[model samples]
Target: KKKKKKKTMEMSLNLASSSTSNSVFLFNPILSGKQLAFPCRHQRIPKRVKPFCVKSSINLSGPRQTLSSNWDVSSFSVESLSQSSSRLPSFEELDITNMLLRQRIVFLGSQVDDMTADLVISQLLLLDAEDSERDITLFINSPGGSITAGMGIYDAMKQCKADVSTVCLGLAASMGAFLLASGSKGKRYCMPNSKVMIHQPLGTAGGKAMEMGIRIREMMYHKIKLNKIFSRITGKPESQIEGDTDRDNFLNPWEAKEYGLIDAVIDDGKPGLIAPIGDGSPPPKTKVWDLWKVEGTKKDNKNLPTEQSMIQNGYAAPE
Candidate 1:
């Protein structure tokens, strides 16, 4: 019963150019460090005085690589800033004419019953009825909450008329990660430091532990329900999901991908966040996902995708 320690970092930046402005958002993991370190936060430089580049640099100890962002004058959005937070994702949708065709989208964020899904659904409705389409990348960063809620959101994603891609940021553990993976039309992805965990669901009943028999039955029920969710995503057996859940260790990005959980490796393209605790938390982490996938499907318990296969496919090399 070992656990993998995980760190998730979130960041945001506002950029201005004439009448239009844009915000870049990201959530990345410091999953590649020996000592669990993070980079320094950068100041928001004034747009006029700022160089053409909105440069941010980060250095981490051990296997973690240095991450930097230096944007060019050419890379930017032309949309005006007279917008609402609700309107932000709408910018990602596109317009296609002479067809009722819709684009793919995988909307991720908070767990079900969370406001994240509501906004996503409404946005999709607008895109659908208004004669436009979009495929989406749902960038997810959540610790997980509410099992039924998560499944409800997943169903919504399936019902969406377009393609959906879910990019895991930070921790996609528990139901949060579960729903995130469910969004992919083809497959799921994770950042280098991303972590995914699944275990039997748990609950604290007001009834005393003295009612041990009933509680035992209830726990078993939860186990079955959780196993079903895992089975749907990975094509793995419920028994396997139970085994992994009971073991209590977290799976790093590579392990997750190998297990048929994540499809590829992607950088959320953001910095790790450091709180005042002075541990390995800082800012200046801006990252984005560019998908790279290996071909071939799963067989037995092995993962094979190339003419040259992996030396060891399941675990990330230790930091």
Candidate 2:
């Protein structure tokens, strides 16, 4: 009996040692007593770890949600941009009033096209309506263009209430010379260095021979009319005017004055007096006030001689 009891005790001790060899023990300084632990082949526990948690209001029964009282977003808009741009001035705001006022000078410096002729006519009529008694000056610096256009302007000048004074600044050729010659008798003037040219009217015709012949006839008629006008103005014979205008006849200011195309050659030294030509004799030294001096005396000023007084004084009208 004693031997069997001893054998049972030995077997119990061996089982306890085998279980201890299969188990693991972890030493945790935080724990007061030793805790039993199991060894895991596939899982591990980290030495330091932090807990993750979400906070909430005291009420926990209702659904969790968030609400924002204020929110702002910025973006570009076309209306706002247009309103900002409208504050700037446009191209049409440019002022031309001062320029027009300073230079009462009318410019005929381009080709004598229909548009140019119309503009000149309208401007002259406006000036005439503005002040009929004041002189209107027309400055010509053209190489000449449409004869019909030039004639339109010329006729308007003759009919306008104001006296039209034509001044040639540069080359007054072809139709330009015609207009220059048609200025108010004593008002036609040319700069000393300008050139004047006159030539027969020109035209281009095509189609049937009859059509071309008709055009030729029309051109001849115009030529005849122009000869008459020139003769009347320059006191030259029609034949002479025809011969001179047969081809391009270019003349300097002095020659223009000699040909009666212009009444005077503007002298830089004498502002308003007519400059003399190459002839030995001096030109008539007339003053602007000479024409009005008699009228001025007629007002009983006695400061000058009246036209009647001049007549009584044997001073005949200047030749």
Candidate 3:
């Protein structure tokens, strides 16, 4: 009689394990075209003083094993791809969105530069609706960016159906930092390594000093508009908002919490139910401009912002 080959069942488990040094481990898999889109799932992570794993893997090959424990696993996830079907489910429909129970909040990081408003919106759209009901955490790590762009983000975060708790990772400076302080309703927090800043919008222009002087005047007017938004969210007075954003203030994580910038300093995951900031209000008004502003450039009257539904704001795309 031939000895039968031993059979074994295969399954992957995701555990939230942390180290005394604040090291974390995270593993997940994405399927594509009946194949793993990126076979090498191990992603090179940014080196932090605390060793932490992420959605991908990290390098543990240093001669000096700085980390107390090296986590390695072969089985991650085995998902099947459905082919032969006439049509398929779009990633937008099947993605993870509101995983409140899972404590898996999606942080768009900061749109300081390349991280544009559109990119963050698209990412949120990919989240599955089921996850929307779950507590959605935003792990913000940014130093603020465009004034107008930040407001666009503020509108998005302020209107989340999911429970959003923002935890600052690095520096939430300028417009980026202020938005977080105001946008989070229930649990606003920061890491020990985080910092916050509020200042006037600064930009470079191509013009003469005389023209530059006029530009500064226009920018200052817009400065008040930004201040109002920050003050409304932070519950601060316009007087205080203007003074802080006037290049006269910089706040570390400690100063941020003291000044109502953040709610708490959480070392790890927070467990509880948090009400959403607010429901979806009426659509924002469009900012129409003189077509003549662009020399001979025609405007698409049909594709105006007023016509576009709030769904197109990058939250969830219409099927």
Write model 1 residue lDDT over 1-319, tens digit each, in one string: 1233222221111122221333332335655533333333445787676548654555444353211123122322454324433433233233321111232233455555657666666655554444324454566787777665666666766776655667778888787767656865454667776778766676665566558658778767867876787787788887777766763447777667678777666543222121112232212322331121212112322543443444256443334
**Per-residue lDDT of model 3, residues 9-105, tens digit only:** 1111111122323433332455433222212234457787976767645556655442112322221122223433444545433444422223345
Residue lDDT tens for model 2, 141-230: 998999789889989999988888889988999989999999888888888778999999989989997798799898899899989999
Top candidate when judged by TM-score against the true structure = 2
What's the TM for model 3?
Answer: 0.48
Clash tally for model 3: 15
Q: Relative to the true structure, how large is the alpha-carbon lDDT of every model?
A: 0.55, 0.74, 0.57
**Model 3: residue 182 alpha-carbon error in angstroms:** 3.3
lDDT at residue 25 of model 3 (Cα atoms): 36
Q: Which stretches of candidate 3 lie over 4 Å from their true place?
A: 1-104, 128-131, 208-214, 268-319
Candidate number with the higher TM-score (2 or 3): 2
Top-lDDT structure, candidate number: 2
- Model 3 — which ten-residue stretch has the worst lDDT? 7-16
